[model samples]
Target: MTSSIVFDPLLPWPLLAVLAVIAALGVLLALWRGLPGWLLRALAAVVLVGALAQPSFQTEDRAPLSDIVLMLVDQSASQTLADRATDTEDAAQALAARIVARPNTELRRVDIGDGEDNTGTLAMAALNAALAEEPRARVAGIFMVSDGRVHDMLQAPDLPAPLHLLHTGRQGDWDRRLIVKSAPAFAILGEPVTLILRVEDDGAAPGDTLSEMRISIDGDTPQSFDVPIGEDIEIPVTLPHGGLNVIQFTLPEAAGELTDRNNTALVQINGVRDRLRVLLVSGEPHAGGRTWRNLLKSDSSVDLVHFTILRPPEKQDGVPVTELSLIAFPTRELFLEKIEDFDLIIFDRYKRRGILPAIYLDNVRNYVEQGGAVLIAAGPDFASADSIYRSPLSAILPAEPTARVIEEAFRPKVTDLGHRHPVTADLLGQETWGRWMRQIEVDPLEGEVVMTGVDDKPLLILDRVGEGRVAMMASDHAWLWSRGFEGGGPQLELLRRLAHWMMKEPELEEEALWAEPTGQTMRIIRRTLGDSVGQVTVTRPDGTEDQVQLEEVAPGRFEAVYEGPEIGLYRLAEGDQSAVVGLGPASPKEFEETIATGDALQPLIDSKRGGVVALQDGLPSIREVRDGRPAAGRGWLGITPRDAFETLDVTKTPLLPAWLVLLLASAMIVGAWLREGRS
Candidate 1:
């Protein structure tokens, strides 16, 4: 229990001050008058004033809350290396047990994990969170168990009590990690691109020499060369193909190294084409030919080779064929000799008019089989008696022409499958887009129907033949959609997506696995036309598979997030789909090739005037040292003692009761005044 005297004045302090001055003046006037009645009046006035000031003795029961000790455990990717995790766990358990055994101390254990993507170990952030949950007065001290590679040092909160770090690793540990100082996402194929690579040796003495580093491309033979201790060197690498190229770089570990996980780094560079070669063969010349030519020629990257058969087998209007147009179409050069050189071939309103021989059609079929793309824009001629389906090229086509054409105006709508396919999906959702008016009707078989026309027949079909892809747009009147006959559409975007898809762009693949690393969290996305995908298997750098089920939020998009356990190249595979993504850096800031040394954390340790005691040397005993005293002694871990005291008893005695003082002073003055008056 505690007690104190509290005053409750009847008047405000300003008013009381005025009253005190007036009473003092009246007493002075009575004393100067030397009258007995005046003295009695003064005493009566003082008694009245004392009664107005209210005062009370307050007492209450109280209990003391226990002091809290924050225990911050680093469980980041670095802590998981080798026996460091075990060390941290054991230290935390021991500290918690000891704190619980104390008489008036409570333990708050906070586990600090890796940051969101791979930012690093956010030790200070965890400390701040733990501090926010507890009372500052109750905080006895803070104990941190970590490798001491904290990234958010600026965010560290003001400690109410002493802070201590129980370092986790041993001294004299060394590490070698591969660091890619600079790398580009997209590089032109066949051109040399410089990649900045740094082979660093951490925890080693300044004079220590680093061994050779190996650089390789796609698991090919590695080139070995020596690198300096702490400098970046430029290495030129050329991509072999116009696709994704995976490059791996590694450094050999020295003796007494902590880990080899950070010794290797993988980079994925997308290769871009120097030129997009396109072959456009027209069976008949019309206004649409100008449209096709303008579209292909508009792109600076596109190299279009357009050929039109103005003189058909039935037309004999030429005075002399050589004089009309002397330049002959190099059918063999395009179809047979350099078929693979062209990325895509478009057949617009073409029929079996014997312009391209059967041998050239055979070559085109072989081109489609060998990863070449082909697009057939059919008109009424596709359904006529002279349809190209009767030619040798029909064998490789996805659908057979019915030889019946419906030339009616109808709105083209996307199919259910098309709503999820990359090429047509979300094309109509844009506010600036318009609708297509006329579409040709055609029955599709053994292919994906992307668009439907009159009578719900397929207007557009896409199919994969062998390694190549083929798309058939049943109508040449698609240009009418662009001309806004009824309403305009996103004609240019549709064509661009179609062309890129045919070229097998990675982002346009029907089934793909893409992962983006922010911090420690990997935002994994799986795209497929299938209803639901199986569990996604993620293989870490250590070759451990973590399988997680995906949740389908949309028709074709499936997503899930995995908190990366470590910082390295993580391979994610969903069914047959696989992608390699880097988590954090080539080496984590904490581990960075894990041979433990006192280098990176030396500044922090020295700032606190702390010493590094190796666990391998001996387990040190804890001691309560005085504040400002040396916190380390021989074979002992010194803990500074705080001068803390508990309230035993509290009491407040008023100088004197206002009533008692008033009565005593009045009686003395009245007796003195009466005696003086009698004298």
Candidate 2:
């Protein structure tokens, strides 16, 4: 297919040039001297020099290679929202057929799925990878069939040829998105936290701008109200308890919209206590009193106010303030004034010694009824006539003390109920537990008897008042375990669980339902006191429901891993308890802007002389255009023909033979000699 002249010199070109110069000089000298046959001699010298310069006619056999055309099909989640999926499929088929029909062209079709981990549409990244795999010289064109909501636009590759985008979705398509502009991951419990949110419609949305919004916590019944569209609204939330709290906001889906996935947004905020204020009242100095104080003081988040009544009201001897080493307890400020501010109050070995009046004790009783926690660590005095149970505080006490104390050594035992209770479940290996030497006899009035001592008497009882919690431990010898008695049991851990449970920690709740999102799967957890748990109903963002069964991993803990097939908020319900958790991001990158537009891909397309044409109008025909020229027009998309080829074989033929040169030179010499003889 290609031909050219090639040379192979019999002698070096430098030596040939010298011989030609000498021959030309000889001819010039003879002509000047009027010598015969000077022209013949010069002709003979030229013929010999030309024969030394070997030249051949070269020809090559070549094969033409087809130009490669790449088609990027975007099948991400957004593309399936409405009729965009149909548009994309049909357009891709049409374009592939058209490209294949062209002369000497090959088609490479690549499908783009949802980006990993909800990264949205990776159209550009996928296209760049496809380009890297093919030969750049042979790549004639690229096309994208998508909704145009690409997230990785910065990864667009340099155009080997023009890029043409056949957009899906119609101009009248619209979507409503609920955006949580700002939400903190941590919030203080019992304090109002503000969340900034906005609900707006993209594309064309009809009806009033004011839309109804529903807000729910922990998947409870949502509260609805009208919120103005296109405005950031501040929603104040006061968390009911501590630990992970899930709040979900939703906008009711209308008749015609892309999806309701973006219509709902979920925000998880961990509720933590700003400060745990504890009131510790000790009746007298004892060996175990320091254990409670040390435990509470060790936590930096706890504010401990400890008071030891060293001198009772009966101490009216001549020991005045000068001799006494104690100051009066702030009973009025603690029990009456600031009792509600404290999260927990401990009555350790405390008895009615007249230090705190009946009025103060009554106030403490009222405090427990109004969402406060009370823990009574009993000592020998708890069974005496001066026991605090004799005061008005006995109204909320879970047990009533009998005037008897068991002083025999016996290891404390966890009751059947305690094995199912979060506070004492899985606390220790019961066989290795140490013994407590003393325990007060008490009759369970109203509460759960979680622990027992010798003769199966109540050692620990827990109960809930109106909106608060109360706990009673019948023995003061728990410090023996802390001191490593008989291979010390889980004393610290038990006490910690008790304190947190009394403070209403969500993880320490006896009954709870929540879901933790883990990479496209939700670890649905259900904590209950019941023997068996039921199936959990999962409600997807698309209003589809799935029943998932839970497996018991521990005595009271049950869980199941549910694979999340879609992105957005998922509601889980097991019996009376319901929970809401966002498996993937509630506002996914794909659905962030559901309405199709070419703004993101336009710049990349323009850089390569490409154009974005909506498929809703029509599937454009394919054509071939020159490189660097406009490749997109009103009714067609263009690809450039690279005109590239590969050579197979080569051949060469000499222009002149050695015998011909010799014959021509001999004739000229004979003619010159004849002419000279005639002269």
Candidate 3:
């Protein structure tokens, strides 16, 4: 109910000014002529001008809207730590009740959660979003209940009213965290790779030191060593094998520390082969020999040593014994002296000859037993007496020659077991690859037959002996398949899988189980010939076991997915088989440091001129103070109220009406003249 005066004009200001000047001049003329009626004439003219302007009263109807108080609550991972969650819940409920109790005031609660990855809290972003939803005029103030760790401080909105913070942490809260400053993805086996690690103390008292750090590989006994505070230290770690290696680093817990969860860290490094040394022995010089050489030499990682036997001992093409063109083969140095230097030995159509004595063959067998790979490509001579199976190498060979060879054109087909084996599975679709001609027949002994030729005879046999593997391709005509004689086969993929399988690649194992983490879920895969696996027993971080049944999705591939409830290392086992895989980072954002403290949110509090108030200090009462006044007190924080008002009634008075002013002015001048003449 406010009131104010308003004005209303009937004519333009210029016309009104001209009329005033003319009237003033007329009055002056009458006065100078000694007319007594001049004064009365002036009074009449003013009255007429006032009656011409039309005016009216104006009023506005307004009902006051409720004042808005925004309450931003930090519900992120950091807020869930220790007693902070309970503190925040209590503070939020109390603040909401107080704001609602005030006359004509409303409370808007905004919950802030964890950001993607380890990006920290997004407090300011939440604040900006809440501000946009409220009416600017009715907004009284903003209040935030959070730990001091806000990541988006620069994004805080330009608040129309004062902003207050009710922090939810204690002053003496502290934490110790293990930080992996640097780590590489790949490392050479048996070589020491330096990883930079640091143990940091946050919100700790000055002069407190971290005494010891323990490092371990795959849950083994930890090696304890001294580590200085606040400095990066290099720890040299040697990978023991060629595969995935998990390393765990931990720091000793100090007195008055916030939480021990963040005191440890886990890292995974993929181990690579030191070197792929290959020894290719060719029995005779042929076009297929060049194909094997070209394939092995093309790879930069492969160390290839090619040795070809161009002439046998029984050859009589030499002119003389001393003047022969062929040189004596050094079978002793190659097969016996340096055989251990090679990781794999490939024989392309090689046969037993007097060149390589029985003693050398025995050394080759020992080489295969001591973690070495061997691949034999048998030819027509495999059915003859000169076959390598007749030599000392027969002990390591997976197949024996039947002395009856089938020389015919046929397309090789993968067996049912091979379809599930990583080597031949998905070779070229099931029925879609080019065909091969000229497959030499052989009989496989106690090995798995992956491929069969004409008459359903084994063409490719694979077996394991000792710690090593042996693969026998009973056909030297595989090059014809590469040349697309009949059509063409998956010659390249077949050859690659064969070579890698012989090298004992983990992925190609027939009976294998592995799991990989994908966010909160894990993909558990098992490759086996069994129709179905028994219930897979899963051991969680909390030492709870859950049996999950696996379903056969493909011919031999079995899989069962499990979603981990928390982040940590998960162990999966079925019968005698077992595997270990990490689900997430050692210290997840939620459990990084469970204790609530103001260290993380300090920057935000300092920038906004706000301070932390622990719930243990008693839940403070909320109040609305005037703008620019102090917003916090001994037991509570205050939200400032804005001074705002609105206009209600307005009345405008008319200056003059045009017609009345004209008639009165005409009469005034005539009457003035009459009075003067009478005088």
Best by TM-score: 3
Q: 224, model 1: CA deviation in Å?
A: 4.9
Kindly report which residue pairs in candidate 1 clash with one another: 115-520, 116-519, 116-520, 116-521, 117-518, 117-519, 117-520, 118-519, 118-520, 383-403
Q: Which regions of candidate 2 fall more than 4 Å away from where they truly are? A: 1-61, 204-212, 216-229, 240-246, 252-261, 322-325, 399-416, 428-446, 451-458, 480-489, 518-520, 537-546, 563-576, 582-584, 645-679
- Candidates sorted by lDDT, descending order? 2, 3, 1
- Local error of candidate 1 at residue 63 (angstroms): 6.4
What is the Å distance of residue 326 in model 2 from its true position? 3.5
For candidate 1, lDDT tens digit of each residue in 251-323? 7765667777777877878889778999999999876777788888988999999999877778777578757
Question: What C-alpha lDDT do the candidate models reach, one value each?
Answer: 0.74, 0.87, 0.76
Which regions of candidate 3 deviate over 4 angstroms?
1-59, 116-120, 152-155, 205-212, 221-223, 252-255, 315-330, 590-611, 616-636, 643-679
Write the residue-wise lDDT of candidate 2 on 1-679 in tens digits. 8999998888899998998898799889878977688888788878777778878899999999899999999999888887878878988998889888888999999999988877888888888889889889999999989888899987877889998888887877877889989999999988999999998888888756898999988767899999998999999999876787778888999778888878888788999999989999999989789989988998898899999988787877876677766777888988888898899999999998888899999888888898999999999899999999999989999999998988899998988888989988987689898888899999999999988999999999999998999999999988988888888788888888899889888888899998889766989999998889999999987899999999999887899999988766788888899877877775778888988888888888887788888888898888888988899889888889998888899998876687888798888778778877787
Q: Between the candidate structures 1 and 3, which one is better when assessed by lDDT?
A: 3
Of 2 and 3, the candidate ahead on TM-score is 3
lDDT of 3: 0.76
Tens-place lDDT per residue, model 3, 40-141, is 778776655454434434444444567888888888877766678888898899888888999878889888888775556788788777877766777887
Best of the candidates, lDDT: 2
